[model samples]
Target: MTDYVSTTPGLYPLPDWAKDDLSDLKGHQKHDLISGDESEEITAAYEEAREEVIGVQQDADLDRIVEGQLRWDDMLAHPLAVHDAVETRGIVRYYDNNNFYREPVVQDDLGFSGDVANELEAAAELLEADDDLQAVLPGPYSLADLATDEQYGDEAEFLGAIADFLEGEVDAFPEHETLFLLEPSLVESAPEDGLDERASEAIDQVAGATDADVVVQPYWGALEEKVYAHLLDADIDAVGFDFVAEQDDNLYNIQEYGATDDVSLGLADGQNTLVEDPEAIRDRVEWVYDQLPVAEFETVYLTTNTETFYLPSGKFEAKLEILAEAAALAEVKAA
Candidate 1:
């Protein structure tokens, strides 16, 4: 039987404790926290929030646990914005979503700031001894696409520099079970114009920087063959495809590509407000599995297509519960 592990793409809904004064704190207070001016009240509130979310995931019996990314105030651009070499530019739409992120402008050579590593370490302290912890970060190509480049005028040069910069950041990450490199730009824009090969080389640099298993999760939708096949060149452990948003295309891609050593099948829709019943979710997973080249993969991960931050707090737990139950059901059915 395949090891059908359940996990998330990180950036969970903001905990309730941090939501009370959100309107008042939207501008200045948020800046204060991001700039390292957090107050005692804010610190305590986040701690409680983290613990609560962590407890929820633990209770759901998820195989891999994330840090909840409560401090990722700027979404995928947060890590870059906080880097000493990058500057926070004007707000820009995050991919096709209604959400926005402060575009990080590369002003100088990039380097690791140790922020994510510290956050992961704190999360490790809160987990049980036997729990398997995982860390998530934006992939190099995606970060480059999100940021404005001033230091490096050329795209190829900028991409190479960004890869090296992300390598340093990954080096700082604490030892974990897996490192999920979220690469939305790769699929969202579809590099059918021959940019896919260059992206493959850059992706290899970032993934090779880490010793932990690296899973490239392109969340928006299915990738074209040019981009998807290039992923085979990258030295990553698993490739995640979103079956929720692009089930038809994803299934087609999987069948065409045959399969891989491991696959992370995104079943839950994090963007939608409607929560799914566990039985329905189980059936969906089973349907996807029926089409999958199961013999080609040793393990499969059940997860949401994107980050859960888009979800309302009240619906987050239900989604996770559904995911957990579906994972168990899928495993049983496969057995």
Candidate 2:
């Protein structure tokens, strides 16, 4: 099996060049650039920024680098490449004004758009060119969470369509050992009444669609086994557990679920500036290693739970430095 390590959770800060372009666009109040005809100046700026990030990864000696998610706004924007990927009319309120939610729109019959497919192909090419890096695509459950309610009538149908779309995208990128990191951020907000059943059904529908190894990541809190039992049974390759949130300690129950599959130890805090102690993180990894073989340790990817911290560029870079340091320490200790 191929081994991997994430630079950190969320995105790396946009390099100076990218920032300059963004500032220029903002100065002109050009919010529509991302969707409209590509500006030569803007495209050049994006390339310089991307090259700088890729160069940083090479310099760091990091084995697997992320495209740094410089392209997509966030996981929600992943499917935006598709024509009318979402319906603007029916929107769901997110946790706060900063985060709004929408559902994915599926036509009367299941259909995939060439625009989305082409965009994904282009994204794959961008990541593939950088031989040192691997790519991560948003998982189906998270995509469903962001879609508008009017899109699917029922969540299952919406999620199933997402699954089918993702399956094709994964197939399209056949050469790379890509990790389809499923971010189920909305699972935490399920109505108190039937949260478990709803979460399970969503996970099952999406997990069932992909052939590539899937990693189910529940970022905000501990994942109740009952809620993720379908993922476990669906033969998911790994489960990413966040250890930074309020109830992170609850992840200890993961041991009871079984250590046979990959367990991504999400120890780095993506939201805070507090640098994590490498020794402390190593201790956590060691605990898991004790239960599983060192060879299996490669399956333990370290990352943050969410990417909310990425909006402001400066903070993002600080987090990246911390992650690089922590990853280095983990490698030394593991060695």
Candidate 3:
């Protein structure tokens, strides 16, 4: 028997009004860098949006809930970008997509400042049980690969340093059921000849940081055989595969390398505007489950192939609704 879970892997889509408020806030920051001007209206708007998103997840009857990551202005680079030891460099295209983010430029040794931990805690306050919360963060490899490193000149050394920085962040994290490490860079820019092990070591560093179950997901496409093989060696509880962009490679890797007790199936197309039928999503889950080498799965998560931040809020909502319904169907069949 396999347990089923449902969650969005990255920043949930923001309401149109919240986006306007955020844009205005950014304009204010750009106009006057010295002023520590905080917008109460924007804060209120964020709080409202957060509450609404939580309500949506609850309405969908999801097994696990993410804080929606609505506070993320820089996506993966926000925590590092806001740190005193780092600076925001020019924008970089995000993984061949129509999106962009300000890359974090690390100038000194980094430490956790509870940036995301605070966000997670806020979500915790609204939930009935603390155990239902799940947190999402950029995996160590993606953060280091996407950023501009000024301090550590060595490649491997910088890789390990990012791991240590993330460890510090999760070391300060509040109690939760799971943590999702988004590592789209692994699929977009595959590791070199011998660096796969180093990347895995870096990932395992953060995986060992907290008590929560860790899931490292690579999206934007499927991973190569060697990359997938090395990733399975990591100490994390599960590895998620993108079934939307590149399904065959992902399916092949699972068949050849086997899988952990738990696995994440990215059945929804996050970037697309169309919403999948709930039955279709459920069928895909069962199909993937049947291909698993193991007799039973400890857990199988229903997720988007990648982040849904680019999709419209209405469509994103519909997708989650579909995802939850699909998960319900899968659970019933598994039972």
Candidates' TM-scores?
0.93, 0.76, 0.94
Weakest 10 consecutive residues of candidate 1 by summed lDDT: 23-32
Q: Quantify all predictions' global Cα lDDT against the true fold.
A: 0.81, 0.54, 0.83
TM-score of 1: 0.93
Q: Which has the higher TM-score value, candidate number 1 or candidate number 2?
A: 1
**Cα deviation of 260 in candidate 2 (Å)?**
4.9
lDDT of 2 by residue, 39-118 (tens): 77765666667666666665555546555655443335445433344433334444444543333344444455443334
For candidate 3, write residues 1-335 as lDDT tens digits: 67788877968888877777777866755222211124686667778889888887877777778889876667776677777788776777776866677777889988667778877888888786533888899998888888888999988999998899889989888888999999998988889978888898899889999888899999978888888888888898889999998877888898898887788989999989999999999999878767767777788888999888889989988988998899888889877
Please identify model 1 stretches exceeding 4 Å from their true place.
Answer: 21-33, 294-296
lDDT score, residue 127, model 3? Answer: 82
Better candidate number, 1 or 3, judged by TM-score: 3
Would you list the rank order by lDDT, best first? 3, 1, 2
Per-candidate RMSD, Å: 2.0, 4.3, 2.3
Candidate 1 vs candidate 3: the lDDT winner is 3
Ranking by TM-score: 3, 1, 2
Window of ten residues with lowest summed lDDT in model 2: 29-38
